[model samples]
Target: MRTGNTTMRAPGALALAAVGVLVLAGCGAGGNNMTLATGSTGGTYYPLGGEIAQLWSDNIDDVNVSTQATGASVENLRLLDNGENELILAINGVAANAANGESDFADEPLANPDDVTLLGNVYPEVLQIVATEDSGIESVADLKGKRVDMGPPGSGTEVAARQLLESQGWDPESDVEAFNSTFEEATTKLSDGQVDAAVAILAVPAASIEQVATGGTDITMVEIAGEEADQLMEDNPSYSTMEIPEGTYQGQDQPVQTLTNWASLYSTSDLDEEVAHDLVQEMYEGADDIGHDVGDQLDAETATESRGPTDLHPGAERYYEEAGVLD
Candidate 1:
């Protein structure tokens, strides 16, 4: 468990003076407190965020970081824009939409999109389309007129699902029966025959998919390849092609081609450069503590190469340049 300062204030004048001193000291006179917004409980972001946050708090001096469980990507970006979170793990594609006031953020984009800077790319969030073997969903084209879980509202999965449906020239709202639910809920529904297929944007070998496979429901991974995937990637520059190797998940014998968006760390440009520098330094130095498969992907070279929608944070850039990773 994580510990935080919880001293209550006293009422007297002398007490107020003491509190004032404590506040100043706590606000960098002593340390800095920050919150990292991650994804739903069943997804990779929540657990991974906790490990990363703990790693930073343990290794960085005077820095106390906490992780917030969120709806993922879109919501995380909104939280960052509204100042509810100091740091966030978001899909680079969603971040681009938020920056440009497109898609989910069409009504109100980030107040200062330029100020949202990238720390580094954490991992690839592959678009995993899992369908029950009985659903008859052999391909993306077969999703028409079927029951599909499009992921939770305000999640990157939701955005990706809609975009994919659009890429096929179908209206997401009218063409399919869409259910907006968390990955856990969607998996449960899939296992119980409540939904035919579900969409997830997560690391390979996702626990939710694992549960369905082990729960006696034969599942098939729908491929997001060919001309459709190419057009999707061409239209959404933030996305790229990726492959989930054979046997990454239960019952998955062959490699599956799919679209991928990077899961990158983001923070406002106002973060202190020195603090950001130290944070990036410790992220790589203490990477082992992350305790997740994704941690293995963290390195100065890949970190510097996977840029986000906005410019890289100067502090992060400095660390990468000095480490001889940035070109």
Candidate 2:
């Protein structure tokens, strides 16, 4: 939705360039075939989603696969709940919230609990705080009475950022100045000293966060460790202990503590079992340099992290069982 005079490679170009793809077994048209809903074009989900869609198309027969650019995690789940069950890339946190119908989306589960499943932990996303040293903001506790960008309205980052704030006992509405600004706007406001801090939720090795760090703002990250954090994790199983290994950001001397969730691929319950199985099997086997626009954060070890969520689809169950990955 953003038109730019400047082009910064549009995040996931190579995969999108290869977009006009269909499922492997010539799975006919898009009416009932599998579909995937990714995030905004400027974000990592889009291109990574394209590659996953391509993988499904190439592996499964007679099951068409396609990708649609959407408002990221929450919208993806909403679509699935409404019967758009192809596939989606979402923050582990959003997936958990969507699964249980708690917190931000406390109305109800978007889809039936059994209809969704975790494809895998695609990557580890970090909860980050960026600010100038002179801003006098250092930890989560100091965030009250300051301007912060939790994230966009429909994005996964917003959902997690709000939870992190509430866990710290900060009143997002009354105690602090909170705005759901875009990444570009947030960074610009921070650089201009108009905003005291930008609270973000993103995967490790996030290129956008790295760029903000490099923008001469005396960038430093906060360690979000405590019993409160543990409570947050306990309340939402999507998040687990996250660490920013030294040199992860531009100016960190040692590890910084954060919470992260698996960035997973998901599908609706309607997906045919054999087709879903083949799709998962293909993604597991076809890791390559797909060039995600937000940045390439994939690797051999990460792509195969063990222990995904409990809501396993029948098709993916077959893949895991057959690969000897599940017992």
Q: For residues 82-201, write the lDDT of model 2, one tens digit per residue.
A: 754457787767776766677656876664755776665566666777766677877777777887777667778788777877777666788888887766677778777888888667
TM-score of each: 0.90, 0.80
Off by over 4 Å in 2: 1-34, 57-65, 108-111, 292-310
Model 1 TM-score, all chains together? 0.90
Segments in model 1 whose C-alpha atoms lie over 4 Å from true places: 1-28, 306-309
Tens-digit per-residue lDDT, 1-327, candidate 1 = 122223322132234334553221135554666778899998999999888877877766677677777899999988887766778999988988887789888887778787788888888889999999999998999999999999988999999999999988999999999999999999999999999999999987788998999999999999999998988987788888899999988899999999888888989887888778877887776787777878887776777454645889999999888888886
Pick out the ten consecutive residues of candidate 2 with the lowest summed lDDT.
1-10
Worst 10 residues of 1 by lDDT: 1-10
